[model samples]
Target: MKNLFIPHFIYWSLFMTSKENYHKVSILLSIYKVEDYLEECLDSLLNQSYHNLEIVCVDNGSPDNCGKILQKYAKKDSRIKIVTLKENRMLCGGRNAGLDHATGDFVCFVDPDDWVEKDHIKAMVDAILTKKDSLGNPYNLVLNRNAVSFMILADGSLKKMYDFGETSGEKTLNDVNLNVREDTEVPMWGRLYRKSFLDAHPDIRFLEGMNTDNIPYTFKLLAHMKRFYVIKGEENATYWRRLITPEGAITPVVLWKNMEIPICFDNLFDYLKKHHLAKNLRIPYHWFFTICFPRHKDQPRYYLRFKELMKKMEDTVKSSDVYKQEDRNLCDLLLYAPDFFNFMERYFTPVPVRISRSRIKLFGFIPFWYIRHKERKVYYDLFKIPLFKRVKTDDKEILYLFHFLPIWTRQTDRQ
Candidate 1:
C-alpha cells in the first residue's frame, strides 16, 4: 500500500534526466570596487534557475572587501570561477579577463555592482538556445530588451526603480528610439551571447578606456549578427544597476566631464570604413548621436560640444558611400544649426529636474518640477537622473541557494 517502488523510480528518473540535458552557460562579471553590492550580485548568479552555470568573476583588483567576498562565494559554490588582479583595469579590461576564462557554449556579462531578476539567466538562455534540439539560432544574439536601474541612497537603502518607463520586445537597430533609450539603459548587459558568434567575431570586444565602448560593441552586433530573439514580459531578463553607490558614477554633460560621444563616433567611422560597411550605415549611424540633441542642447557647454559633434558627424556623412545630396544637406543643417523651434526647447525643457532622494520616495509617480538657475540661460542638465519605474514582481524557478535582499526577490522599499 506504500508504493515506495514508484517514488524511487521517479526520483532516479529525474536525476538521470537532468544529467543528460546539461547546457552550460558562462557568466562573465567584471568587478572593480563593488564591496557593498558584491554579495547580492554573486547570490543572483550562483542561484540562477539554470543550475549548469560557470560564473567567471574577475575582481579588477578592487581595494575593498570585494575580492574577499568573491573568494567566499567561490569556496561555497564550485560553479563559481574567480580571477583576482592586482591592479584595477577599469571595466573593459576586467571583462576581458573574465572572457578569457569563459568555457561555456553561451556567455553573459554582469557588472558586480548590479543584480538581476530571478529568472533572468533562465529566460535569457532559453531565448538564446530557442528549442534546444537546434541549439537556438546559433548566430544572432538574444536580448531582454529592457533593464532597470536602482539608486542606492547614501544610507545603503534603495529608493525603488528609477522610473524610466518600460517597453517590451527587441529595440531593433531600425527603431527610432534605439540610440536614445538604449544608451540610457545598460545597453551592453541584460543579453546572452552565443559563444560561436563571439568566437567568430572575437574582435567585437569592449573598447578599453573608451567612454562609449558600447557603441562599437552594439554596432558590431547590429551589423554582423544574423538576427535578434528578444525576450520580454513574464520571461523578464534584466539587471538592476545600483547607481549612486558608495563611489558613485560619473555625471554626463552640462559641464561635459566626459563628452566622448564624438570621439567615439570618429572611431566608429574609422572602423566602418576599414571594414567597408560605411556606405550602408551612414544615416542610421549619424542618427545615433542626433537623437539626443534636443535633450542635450540645454546644457552649460552645449554649444561647445554640439559644434564639434556636428563637425565630426558631417565628415563621416560626407565620406559615406551613398547618400542623397538633399539628405546630406539636411543632415548638415540639423547638425550645424538648430531651427528656432528646436532651439527654444532650452526654455521649455523643464530645467532638467534633479529629483532628490526625498522627492523620489515621496512621490508615487514621476514628477516634473521646473527649476530656476542663477545663470542667464536658466537650463537644467538632461542626463542628471535616469528614467525608470517602480513595479512589483515575483520570483521564478526559485533555485535560491542563497537568499539575499537586493538579489532578484527583494521588493523595492520606495515609500
Candidate 2:
C-alpha cells in the first residue's frame, strides 16, 4: 500500500491571503500512461496567460515515467501540485482525487494527453467572472469553443483537424439552447466549472470506471444551473486536442461498457427523480438512440448487444414524463425500424440552410443568390435583394420555405 499525501492546508494558508488568487482557476490533469505527452501538456499549462492558475496533476498509479515528469514540473513551478495513487483509478477516480486537493475558485479538467491554447484559462476565467445568469447569480458552468482533434502524419505534417463536441449556439445556454446540440452538455473538458457550486452539489461526482460518465454528469449539472454562459467568437479560447485512436471499438470490455450506457442513464434518471430536479432529457434521449446506439448498430460483432441495450434505454427514456408523444414515437421508430428511420432521417429531415450577406462572395465562390419554391411560387434572392417579380399559376405544388438568410431581403414567387 503505497501512500502519498498532499499538504493542502499549508498550501491554502499561504495562497488564500492574496486577493489576486480570488478568481483562481484549478486545472485538474488526470495522468495515467501518458508520459510521452505529459511534458507538453504540462508546458501548455505553465505558459497559460492566466497567471492565477493552479495546475493539479494526479498521477493515477501510472507505471510509466508520468510520476517523474509531474515531479520535475512541480519542482520548477509552485502552481503545480502533484497527487499520487498506488494504482490506476481510471479517469473519474483520478479527477475525483484531484478535486479533493483543488483549491481554485473555478475548476477545469484537462486530459494529460491533450493540450490547450495559452489563453484558454484566461478566456474561461474572464467570461465566468464577469457574466451572470438571468437570476443575477454566477453560472456554474462556462463553455468555450468546440475542441478540434489533430494528429501528426508520417511526414511530420499535421493531419486535417476534425471537430468534436456536436453543439453550437447562443452566448447563454437556456432550455431552447439545449434543444439543439450545443457545447457543454457533454465532454468534461473545454469548459470551466465553479468549485463552490460543485461543492454545493455533492451528488455531481463522476462515476468511476465508466466510459460514458460525462453524459449523465453533464445533464445533472445543467439542471442545477439557472443558465450557463458560452464564450463565442474570437474572445473564446481554443482547446487543442490530440486525436486518439481506439484500440478496438468492439473489444469485449469496451463492448460491455458501451452496452452499459443505458444503465448509467437509468442511474442518472433515478438520481434526478430522487432529488426532484427538472428532467429535460432532450439531449440524453437523442444522444443515446441517435448517436450512441447507432454507432454500434452496424457492427456485426456488437449488433445483438446494441439492440438489446438500446431497447432497455428506450424503456428508460419512455418512462420520463418530460418527453412528448412525438419524442416517444421517434424512439419507437428508431428501435423497430432503424433502417427506415435512417432513410427518413437522411432524406426527410429538415436541415436548416443558413444564408447571410456576409457569406456571399462576388467572385462566384459562394453563390450570391438562392432559390426555393413555396406554394406555386419560386422565392428567390440575389445579393439579398428581390430580383424577380411574383408569378402565379392555376395548379402548383405547395413547398415549404427552404432558404433563410434575412438581410434586407425580399421574397418573390415565380413560376
Give TM per candidate. 0.65, 0.68
- Residue 238, candidate 1: how far off, in angstroms? 5.5
Stretches off by above 4 angstroms in model 2 are 1-19, 153-156, 163-180, 184-186, 246-257, 297-326, 330-415
Candidate 2 matches the true fold with a TM-score of 0.68
Q: Give the per-residue lDDT digits (tens) of candidate 1, residues 247-348.
A: 465334311344556455556666766777665554343353344444664543544454555565676567655544644654565454565456445434
Residue-level lDDT tens digits of model 2 in 16-116: 87544778889998888888788988999999988898899899989999988888898999999999999888777887888889998999989887788
lDDT score, candidate 1, position 201:
76
| lDDT accuracy of residue 297 in candidate 2 | 43
Q: Could you report the Cα RMSD, in angstroms, for every candidate shown?
A: 20.4, 13.6
Give the clashing residue pairs of candidate 1, or none. Answer: 129-136, 162-388, 163-387, 163-388, 163-389, 164-387, 164-388, 164-389
lDDT (C-alpha, whole model) for all candidates: 0.61, 0.67
**CA deviation > 4 Å runs, candidate 1:** 1-22, 131-139, 161-172, 176-186, 235-238, 250-255, 282-415
